[model samples]
Target: MSNYVIQADQQLLDALRAHYEGALSDRLPAGALFAVKRPDVVITAYRSGKVLFQGKAAEQEAAKWISGASASNETADHQPSALAAHQLGSLSAIGSDEVGTGDYFGPIVVAAAYVDRPHIAKIAALGVKDSKQLNDEAIKRIAPAIMETVPHAVTVLDNPQYNRWQRSGMPQTKMKALLHNRTLVKLVDAIAPAEPEAIIIDEFLKRDSYFRYLSDEDRIIRERVHCLPKAESVHVSVAAASIIARYVFLEEMEQLSRAVGLLLPKGAGAIVDEAAARIIRARGEEMLETCAKLHFANTKKALAIAKRRK
Candidate 1:
């Protein structure tokens, strides 16, 4: 009943053809809007110029509107998220995400996952969305389910290692880029055997900077890599990736807390000051580097407080 019209120019139609390929309900006419029914069904009208698809099918339809058919199957071996554009008209996809960059404790984590066309509904069924939108328990419950439904990879940069990298001159943003890129590379390699055509990543930086960083790494992504804002909301793979990353971050934080015998709070803030004091008292200041990210101003401030208390 929820009808929408998508105007197809040469480019849009070409994209649609590639996305739908053998799957289109009918050929589209010029200057016609595609009518789509909600929840995963597409109805096509040649005279009216409308298309309807649901779930994975709907995603495929959207993708066609953007990149055209030529690019659709080109990366079929790669997952959808890795595709150059996310608007293709298929269900198979993959996406990547990271967490803990702003936290003064625990590890920085990057996660990636492959969502096949058939599994989009399964993911949505599990209430998969952006990890930030869900609490820790919800993420934990959903993470294993996501893993079961999709192939995934996660990279964790422990606080100590992160500090070492920072001391060696890597900025946090650069470090994040490095971790994300490396995770993506690994994910791509993992999914390449299956031969998906595309992947999408939430844009962390401007287009030029992101491309520059990718170029600097000399790592070529075979599948198309679509970069956009709020990609997690638009792409199921990205959403699944975010949940996995957040789950790992929370789990790691708990482990860090147990290792230090105190709860390590999330983020850099005044409460972190108290936690730092506790860590310094229980462990030595020298040990702080092992347990905390030293680059944070919180580390220096905590050290000063520790000295004052002494």
Candidate 2:
């Protein structure tokens, strides 16, 4: 079996725990070790934020944790031609995306953008692309321009609300559907010019499964919905939505850091545990309810550490 070592955080480890739960496992101070659902892969995570992957699918499996990619079913994408200023920007399309869903702290943010023929070329010219490919500083700089140019809406599910949702046993995909559908309707209404000819989604779940999750919602945009993986690679409207959603996520993170008087770091890991312990020691355990998603295993680890501090 091949062995590979790389970085891992608490949240990523938690994901691994969820993914490899049924397999034989061991949790220790050094890290967590488990056999993946596929017996072909065995992985170990370290408290130092490192992960070691061995077995056949090591690289592929490790990437999912590192990238925060959805573990849902994935299908091969028939790549669409790369969009140019004259081609894609010439259509009436609305695009949607979300940010901070994988984070241990902060709210889930969903954003949608409507771009008609007149403004598509403008956004394309601005070089707006996938938010994942761009850094937070880049997003901050580009987001204002999109806000001024596009008709859009952003919905935020802050920590308190997110905690409540989890407590009520809401599944992540269903929550995402609710947010995306809600944002799409609100943004479409905000456009006021015309109904978009099509709504494009940076597909997370399979198309049918995505819609199935929406059954719980009372109102959903009954528009022509087109779901594509990596839609932001060529769709300017989707890219615009991604930028703003990510920008807002960062801004909220900043606000959270300021409130807690510590750089509340992103991702779940050992450092996050330390930060949580700090928050608990300074503000008490209840304060974490406002700052973190209680569902995370990080909460338990941090709480345990907090008790030691007393």
Choose the strongest candidate by TM-score. Answer: 1
CA deviation > 4 Å runs, candidate 1: 1-90, 216-218
Q: Candidate 2 residues 1-310, lDDT tens each?
A: 4454555567767777787778746444344444343577776665666666666555345434544322221223211222222333456889899988778878899999988878888987887998889987899899999999989999998889888888899988888888999999898788766888667888777556677788778887755675666777536899999999999999999999888888888888899898999899998888888878888899899989989888
lDDT of 1 at 197: 48
lDDT of candidate 2 at residue 36, scale 0 to 100: 45
| Angstrom error at residue 222, model 2 | 2.3
Stretches of candidate 2 above 4 Å error?
1-90
Q: Give residue 249's lDDT in candidate 2 (0 to 100).
A: 91
| Candidate 1 per-residue C-alpha lDDT over 1-310 given as tens digits, one digit per residue, 9 for 90 to 100 | 2222343455555555565455543344464443333346564533333433334343334443533322222222232322224343254777878888888888889898888888878888899999999988899899989988888889999877898888898777777777777887787788767855456677676433555555668675634666556778767888899999998888888887888889888989999987898789779876677668887889888887788888
What TM-score would every model get versus the actual structure? 0.72, 0.70
Candidate whose lDDT is highest: 2
lDDT of 2: 0.76
Tell me how far the alpha carbon of residue 9 in candidate 1 is from the true structure, in angstroms, after superposition: 3.8
For model 1, what is the error of residue 217's alpha carbon versus the real structure, in angstroms, after optimal superposition? 3.3
